[model samples]
Target: MSNVSSRVSLSDWGLEPAVDYIERVQRSDGLVPWYPDGPADPWDHVESAMGLSVAGRDEAARRAYDWIADVQHDDGGLWATYGETDGDEGAHAGDEPRKETHRSAYVAVGVWHHYQCTGDRAFLEALWPTVRDALAFACARQAPTGEVHWAVGADGAVYEDALIAGCASIYKSLAAGAAIADVLGYGDARDRWLETRADLGEAIRSRPDRFDRTWESKSRYAMDWFYPVLCGVLTGEPARQRLEAGFDRYLEAGLGCRCVADEPWVTVAESCELVISLAAVGEAERAREIYEWLFQWTDDEGVFWTGYQFEDEEFWPGDRPTWTGGAAVLAADALSGLSPAGELFTERLYD
Candidate 1:
């Protein structure tokens, strides 16, 4: 139940408090609300659930998965946001809104991960219908240009934007699903899906202009610099050079990497992501250092602040994010050689 990795030490870091905080959030129905005092969103819940599973809370993790499954729409998609509720009516009714493709795909990633950890074939089989339909829905929204649309409103309209975050997520989900299909013995389908994922990666690399010119801008947001590289869409010398430039430009001494050029705050998500990016490029020592730095943001309860502002005064607002913890677990898993999904893509077939 402890994260006793030989390569990293947690002795003086107050890890137990952070672990307790993660447990608290898990017990509170796997929802790490963004604002620390706001309503729970599905996105954070999915991420938090994965964190719980990583921390060895199998029962709680399964409950979190059940929570997501219980809220799925009739069309097999999940809402972008939701309140504390247990039924489809709660998720589907009210003025609460939902987005397609991105949110749905994200939830599927968590579910897929849970299945991988548990080897729960029946659980996966039960969700396979929903996962398949969700994949189809996401694929339907993919433009001929290979960019997946960001969202579909509850009104059934498309919100078309090449959000780098969403695009990165879709790539990961598709890759995960393709691997699952292969394991489930859908070899032909797996190859087809893998091919689609490859094409999408190529599109992302070849046509960065199509997504958002701002992402390609020299302004330097941590995500803009790191995500494409993390997703394996950016590779070899180009990715290495880009990450190095980001390090030189935006990294600070005590505060870690800034989300943007002018920002003095260090976001946990971005910082953790930077660790993964560093490892991806074979900078294991630096990556481990960054990972250790991430622990400083953890509170007495294992909850990490989204970020810390350092200019006028210091503050780490809100509850720890599921994405923050998820990123941590993912980075650790990658470093420890335990990510089954990562194993499936050993050769970067997409490139």
Candidate 2:
């Protein structure tokens, strides 16, 4: 992180090609497949959509949000995988893809981002009901322990499990929901959501045992290590401390960030996100260092590879995810100050 100033400028690393990579694979109906023939997950689709918005492709971005509104289930959660041909997980082959709490809640984050970019009150109004219902669905499953369950079936049966990464995401989604509620004139609702977010952050910090009951602690996963900071739940000195805690475990020197603390694989999207997490707490020097390192992951077509295996010294899984390009564009905007919503990822969780 010492040579934070060692990057080519954002103007040289301009985001249009990366943004277009996502738009090119998006269907007319606004589904952004992970790849040309891949399934669209709600969260990744939203991410690609945000990148579109950042690239000044407003119409495509709005269409992306519209697709979410059009397909929202009565129960409010988004189908984890929709109209898919393939998935990273073999589980989505079912007729009805499973629902997940964090994926369902993420519409609020995308909705708020759209509003921030356009200042379109009418657009916010159009999306308000979707945001409100989605957050309610996730909140309804919150345990007395202050952790939201990891997922729920379409039948409404809860998984009753939790994850540090998922809950951290939901915490930020609630902040976005609260922002929407404030704009839509829901004082009590906004205030209540803020209160819940504070409680969730406490659980994440104090109760590591509350999460990932079915598997080993996900602290090994880079997302869980950085999400609280990315979400603004762990800001200022605490955020700085958290980044320091994970730096040696994950950072790969002149390479990129590790996908897992113990693994030799580094991923583009996680590295991009960590840049924002670093910037959120005034760690701009470190943020730029990582972004500069991540530039090495970009391919000739301007799309970033999904991940690289340092042990084998190659791009593993050997595919480019549209969302990875989206993440790169987003991180570039954060560093370049090129868009209104550039700071979206780094913004504070509560007013």
Candidate 3:
């Protein structure tokens, strides 16, 4: 399949301001919060770090990873959320919370992406141990049915239910983990992760009964509908078909993608993810069209808003998140090939 390339460059989007926003919100200890005085989550923090890599803020990106490495628990997990920074320093880890598998596993994706952007083998080697432990932490949660349990509570109670969207993300993280292991010459680790990933893909494709067993169906969410494709579990014609089936239900015409099927709201993050997913299955024109729709939603500082509530015809939530802008930057990179890791979302890690 041909890689997608945008007609416009990253310069055309004028995302320097968005990069500026991420830097401005980054704490002294390297945690990237949702916004100033907002909480930080590991997954979104990693996403923002990827944006820093794409925007030539390599040092900032490295600092972000270092912080992630520092905070990982001995069991190789991290709390789902961290309190906001206290005066430029990171928050204390006194607040114990549940750890989500996908959130803990995402470091592999960020570490691999940073390597792709920089080709810095020394850096990759330095972070290899952290990636190894993180994937180990996540894969240990996989059940015999091949679905991973979503989280474990602070009191050691496991949340046995699985989420399609979260598992699909873990599928991709496993692929990235395997790739990193291969590069570092850990053949045993690489093979193990590959085996786990294949089983997870099977669960995603053929084992619908395994997910959301204890809760209501999550079919209304756009992520659950398209994430398998975004994460490379679905490809070629099958991937394209899955996206087409949900187009009417999730896409908001020229605006963006709706976060949920029944909501009249459009989110920049989901829309940007959709762009990458569309491009993954060779829908270049369609991806570019959706990409154009997001340009009008940026603030005066170029930071994209959280989402727009179309019923009210206004940008709701009144918050601009660093991760949302990060998603936009990632979407542009996927289309424009502006960075070495531009195809990170478009290509499967292995055949």
Candidate 4:
């Protein structure tokens, strides 16, 4: 799968089914479900919009952005889950629940990404106050040592845990916030957030002990293997060597990236993200190969499975995930002549 000669075009793969899936979500109200079987999540909706945008479904993407804007909380935050309210007969029945702060911060990155892709300054301006407040909310939860706490209660209290995934989200949010501030001409705020980002990056690199021991205990999880390097938080000879070594340890020929070295199925999200990471480091050839593998995994419906669960003999047993679509869109954008050249990470590479 890593072979360079195996490149394939997105159009050659017959995208009609994927287009239909995107259209179904777009025609409905703002709610987009993670799977065909479960409830909708705002984060997933944002991701779907990104995928649509990549596929040039501009109108559908715009609708998704509008839907998210409509449902944002009064406190400048968003809920983790939203019940189906699109008036579809026989939709899954359940109570909609909002997550704590950590999840809320994750949504901001998607919103910011949408704004960048569309150049919708008005939409971005409308979201600015909410985005700013959310950033402050996230920043306030940062520990003295610069690592962000895991979550904040609805009552607005900090909940700390140092989960590696949450840390990745925090890094992403801060970077997105800095971009938003720069766009909005909030010079001081942009600098402040950038400084905060630098602090967090340094903390993560210098104090690996602060992270969960489980992250270090195994080299199997694709995220633990690639996220740090992909995020621009890891660099230099040692970092690159670490990633290369891990790739040899965990990468399989035809199955894509395994969650664990011994795992059989490839996780769509992890594989797509790995492509972005590879591209970020100037390995475009390898990134292109991974991109092809990812394109192969998409079903006829454009819905990507969560993972190939060999244990259950299931391929994405649940519904198509929003993040899976999001990863695909983001990676495709990067591959389709869209470079983060003037962005934070690109600048850091030369610095």
Evaluate all candidate structures by whole-model CA lDDT and list the values in order.
Answer: 0.65, 0.82, 0.89, 0.62
TM-score to native of every candidate shown: 0.83, 0.92, 0.95, 0.80
lDDT of 1 by residue, 185-264 (tens): 87776676676677677777777766764334544677767877776777778878878877877777666778787867
Q: What is candidate 3's CA lDDT for residue 129? A: 84
**Residue ranges of candidate 3 with Cα displaced over 4 Å:** 1-9, 84-96
Model 1 lDDT at residue 28: 59
- Superposition error at 324 for model 2 (Å): 0.8
Candidate 3 lowest-lDDT run of ten: 84-93
Candidate 3 per-residue C-alpha lDDT over 113-228 given as tens digits, one digit per residue, 9 for 90 to 100: 99999999998999998999989888989999899999887677888989999999999999999989888899999999999999999999999999989999999999998999
Which residue pairs clash in candidate 3?
A: none
Number of clashes in model 3?
Answer: 0
lDDT of 3: 0.89
Off by over 4 Å in 2: 1-11, 83-91, 94-96
For model 1, state the Cα shift of residue 156 in Å. 0.9
Superior by TM-score: candidate 1 or candidate 4: 1
lDDT of 3 at 134: 89
Which TM-score value belongs to model 3? 0.95
Ranking by lDDT: 3, 2, 1, 4
TM-score, prediction 4: 0.80
Q: Which ten residues in a row have the lowest lDDT in candidate 1?
A: 341-350
What's the candidate order when arranged by decreasing TM-score?
Answer: 3, 2, 1, 4
Best by lDDT: 3
- Quick one: best TM-score, which candidate? 3
Error of 3 at 265 (Å): 0.4
Model 1 stretches with alpha carbons more than 4 Å out:
1-16, 27-32, 35-37, 84-96, 213-220, 337-351
